[model samples]
Target chain A: MMTADERGEIEELLPWHAAGTLDRREAQRVEAALAEDAELARRYQLVREELVHTTHLNETLGAPSVRALEALFAKIDAEPQRRPGTAPGIAMRIGEFFASLSPRALAWSACAAALAILLQAAVIGSILIKEKAPGSYETASVPTSPGTEGTDVLMRFQPQATVSDINRFLETNKLSIARGPSAGGIYRVHVSGAKLSKDEATRVLNTLQQNRIVGFVAITH
Target chain B: MQTNSDEVLIGRIAKGDRLAMQVLYGRHHVQVYRFVLRMVRNETTAEDLISDVFLDVWRQAGKFEGRAAVSTWLLSIARFKALSALRRKPEEELDEDAVGAIEDHADDPEVALAKKDKGAALRTCLSKLSVEHREIVDLVYYHEKSVEEVAKIVGIPEATVKTRMFYARKKLSELLKEQGIDRGWP
Candidate 1:
């Protein structure tokens, strides 16, 4: 009968020996046993072979097709951008949903602007020739700066101008403008007036063919 | 096809060459991915973590001391990331859909998809080994680090390293035999 320590040592040696984990001394001892004993070497080979074959099977299972990797990458790209403790907000979700919205809205807006410019030219002709004012109107705009969105503009009706009048006011003063959000909210004008002199503000003020209290200056011109 | 060596690729990536990054990613992503998947067992999480690994490489390639093989350093990064990901959200679910996607990838496009599969087989087999024995085989055979290096990595005697190697290969061979895989190369 083997002593407890000897039995434990052999047992400890078995897995490593079978798998070839033993260092030279331990390996030599195991090998010497194998040299004197066929059974030990056979057992070692058996264990090693099983490990090899099983690993091979795993390799087969883990093999993914190229289409699969691309699909995986594409899937990763499509995963929702989420943070650790919070769900994504609605506004962003909406933008993501509408990410592919066509330039149709922009084109239509441009057409409307061009038409208004034409109509405004006609109105200006009438006013210049007839020397008379038309009915009441109001003016406002939505913004489209390539930066973080600011407070949304709500529709405001000034008693002195139409969309054409606002457009004219902006054009004459070199101020950009927003008509309105098609979804919701009012039209507003955007004037990049940082460092704008009081003289420049006064020029824009006088050029206002429509009504709007110029809000805060966003950046210094 | 012949590819640039890992060190050269790493140097280029460190220098902020986007093309070099693309090449390096192409070469190592799958291997690193396989290693991560094995450690974490969650394919989607594993996939996500590998990106962090690559990003670190891109950011820190300049800091690499050239002390270890690119593979070893990469595996080390992967190991750290997988552990942290697991620690942060111990319950992070393996996205079944993402895993399915990975399965599909392993099946089709990656020309080396076959190699990753083989690596998976090796990983599963390695998992069956004791942790001590596992590291040795992983560092030497799969990651292909040398014995002296492996000894230094595991902080054990060289003799202990050889003994562990003897047993690791022996057991691996036996396991392969039982599974009807060829145990020894012909």
Candidate 2:
């Protein structure tokens, strides 16, 4: 059995260590204690298990409604006090330009040497397609950011679709609009804050395609 | 990789980058909403306050001096709004709502009554904890905030964070024992 003082010290640090919030020095101390004491080790495991249960409980809470998010975006758009774009904005835009490619487009252009040729061809193709239809791009790049690039899924909705309808469709498929309404009405969407596995992304893409209101669904890179 | 860091996002947000705002909102809005939801126990109210919190972030992005993680900053804003809303309403109404909201409705009534799932039992017990204790547990376990971050967000000393969490865990352990799921911690 551990001494009263030793138990107290271990108890104090166990929660932090299990929470993965203990600083480096303190974490090392806890590790040393756990290595030497079976009781302390058992306590640490209990804390870890409890933390997992607590996390699951919290995960059950419902997210804010779609109407709430749309309102937030509309309010943001109406706000007139936007500051001028800076160097970071420019950088982010450049990053977005690359991230917005459809998976098919990425596949066609994955080879670095052929990237320039493929992109030039795709741009020409999009322009010709746009000339044929105002809101249609046979080959267009959607807008996406760094985190969303690899998981980018390209989707489009009926231009006349209601925000409520669109939001419902997106929410149903667990997709979020990352960037879009580009010249061709293409949108770069992702699996909404998740790094979905290839199978999962494919599943999301398939589910989205089943939605009648969603015109086209394709997983870009 | 570093470009998407919270500080960078805040920097872009300070420059009124709407895209940056969207990114940040997507990243943290759910957690902030959940935090606020637990406090006030009203979904609509929580949703409204979440928007309010982000609007505050949009307006005050420039004021963020990197003293705290973006999550910590957001929770601080959320907690403030939740408390203010609670103060405006009658406490008894909130207490009733909170109790109702925390119960998991998806479980079978018979099973829940006889013996709750560990998660449901824990949540039911957590709902009984004082608002102070609940938030502390939420911050550490769900939000994954460091003790220091919890202290900074809650405006308590680090030592106090540990003490509160200790007591909160003890309370939880007792509740779990009462439910026949004891792990032997005192």
Candidate 3:
């Protein structure tokens, strides 16, 4: 005769046993108990029935819509990329800091940052021009304004390329977004440092074209 | 890439690999959606919560210590989000459509008596279980999770997992008996 505690223990193991998730020893014990005890066998049958019903109930719930994936990617694109090897607490604090800002504040902050970058670029360009010897300058097909003396390449990013991917790509190529993403999802990318000669410009365009993240690239002028 | 183990995919995801994230999402989203749907009961809420769950995955992939299965980690994140969502909308009662649907299955004791489909009756009883009991039942039977995995996902003790499972099964049997489909057990 099975003790009450023994019966309860076997009863608790039955669900896991029916699920095929019990360890071998517990499973063997349950099997042995079932063989010797008709009552335990009946209980195991009920457990199996419950498993079928539960599985059926869950299966009928169906899969999520495509919108779920789309929404997830959209949110990811909006998130600031965490630096590699950054501590979790620091990253979360950074995220929280940005999240705490209002939209207007964020926009104003972005505008101020953009102005700082443009001013710094102008200063750097002037200094480089002053340091160069006359007649040593290479001519490009397109003439740039004094403050904007960089190769302008129009590029389109792949649809699946995220903001982090774009940032990494730009940093590696020493490029910055100079203008519109326009209606066509194209961005005018400014290659920093010296204005490229035609061959150099073509090489840069080719590099962008070959990259996985850039779906299209061309020297706009 | 499709054949990569979940841990491999999670490792890649931790490095900010979009393709890896997409693969992991494809592999698990259906079951995760179903699990959240069972908790939230509204398809729209469940769909939104699925996005939230995976967004957490993308943000926290690096923190996964391999202490639990990837699926268990996902369900844990999903359960936390679902519970928070539930808490935010405490005034929103149980889904009326679902309640009505259950009633439609057996309008009265007389109709329940007339219903001879034990499987259908049992399914109705499963649906009628309290959320706590239903969650435990689904975790064990439907998700086919081990007791340890369920304890991790549910954030309860292993011993508590066993007792909860026993109680959940006992309650399910009682519900079946009430529906006139008793397969005799305490």
Choose the strongest candidate by DockQ: 3
State the lDDT of candidate 3 residue by residue for A98-201, as single tens digits. 87899999999999999999999999999888867676665686555534576788889976466888999999988899887898998888885677889988
Candidate 2: tens digits of C-alpha lDDT, residues A1-221: 45676567568768778878877867876888888888778888878877887787778897888776787877777777665643333444555566788887777666765878889999999877778786654444643335643477787885435588888876766667877877678988876465678888888778778765677878776
Q: Which candidate is the best by lDDT?
A: 3
- Interface RMSD, all candidates in order, equals 12.7, 4.2, 3.8
Tell me which residue pairs clash in candidate 2: A102-A220, A103-A220, A103-A221, A150-A221
| Worst 10 contiguous positions by lDDT, candidate 2 chain B | B102-111
The model with the greatest TM-score is: 3
Question: Candidate 1 regions off by >4 Å?
Answer: A1-40, A61-221, B1-4, B91-141, B147-186
Write the number of the candidate with greater lDDT, choosing between 2 and 3.
3
**lDDT for A149 (candidate 2):** 37
* Candidate 2 error regions (>4 Å): A1-3, A74-221, B1-4, B95-97, B100-116
| Candidate with more favorable, higher TM-score: 2 or 3 | 3
Q: First chain TM-score in every candidate?
A: 0.25, 0.33, 0.39
Worst 10 residues of 3 chain A by lDDT: A86-95
What's the true lDDT of residue B130 in model 3? 72
What would the per-residue lDDT of candidate 3 be over residues B102-121, giving only the tens digit for each residue? 44434586445435788887
**DockQ of model 1, rounded to 2 decimals:** 0.03
